[model samples]
Target: MLNFVEYTTQSALRNAGMRSVISFGIALLFFAATLVSFQVTDASAQSACFERTALMKHLSGKFEEAPVAAGLAANGSVLEVFSSPDGVTWTIVLTQPNGATCVMASGESWMGMKKPKKDKVS
Candidate 1:
């Protein structure tokens, strides 16, 4: 009788362990599927124009100072520009609001211009 009781208890524990492992495996599969689906959706949702290399290339050259503008990002980073007095060379700078500054791009033949004066109001 003691042997039979012990065998039944051992079998029950083994079944419970197997069930737990299967449940864990299924949970992992579900999580992996969710991640893959999110990646697919995110890749399709992005715009081509926002490609990093294309954007960097497009923004690489000189810009007319009067029309080109800079602003603060939502995350408190700053986009700005600096040019030599002769305006033959330019440097684009990105300054984080935290006081860190970096050069984004630089090039020769940059042109600086004075802002156009508005006509006097009648």
Candidate 2:
């Protein structure tokens, strides 16, 4: 079994990977979308899109997920993380400027982290 510190480290690394995926998705969807045959149909978008409050309610009520981290981008988009209690499951959501909230990704085995302390000098 992993100890708390070790688990936190692992979780942080996994979270970083998730962020990398989000970045890749942004690049693919915004920059190189034309290079690929990717398409966001209205039906697909409708399934994923929701009002911010509604999405929050659904996540909390259905999965017991709560916001773990959230931030706003320069383009007025918001990236938010919702995780189940005990760090077992998680979701990454993006809220666009027009108030469309969508689940960008989700997975299990979320691990919470403690605040990092400054390193000591020898």
Candidate 3:
């Protein structure tokens, strides 16, 4: 009887060790999956066409200003437009352009820019 109990104890220990190893493997797999998902999300955000969205008010003929346009390029989409003389109380209004408003927002980082309009030609 004594020998039987001793052998059973050793077997339990071995089984516990195996279970622990399996748990560790599962944890490693989950960690790897999380890392891969994070990398994919970061790469997609950087590759996207629009880095950020902003609302700009047309100040004058070809000028617009905003508090923040960190990722706005010269040719980014004009999602929204607002205007204010005091820069505090803004009014949402649509303004027309005078000259050939080409895709000027491309390649140039802008802060406050007029709302972009889609070109008929392209």
Stretches off by above 4 angstroms in model 2 are 1-47, 119-122
RMSD of each: 12.8, 24.1, 13.7
Order candidates by TM-score, high to low. 2, 3, 1
How far out, in Å, is residue 40 in model 2? 12
Q: What is the lDDT of residue 60 in candidate 2?
A: 96
Q: lDDT tens digits, residues 12-105, model 3?
A: 9999999999999999999999999999999766521221232232333234433332232355423333333334433222222322122222
- Compared with the true structure, what per-residue lDDT tens digits does model 2 show for residues 1-122? 99999999999999999999999999878766654434555445554777788889999999999999999999999999999988788999999888888899899999878888889978
Q: Candidate 3 at 22: error in angstroms?
A: 0.5
Q: Which candidate, 1 or 3, would have the higher TM-score against the true structure?
A: 3
Clashes of each: 0, 0, 7
- Top candidate by TM-score: 2
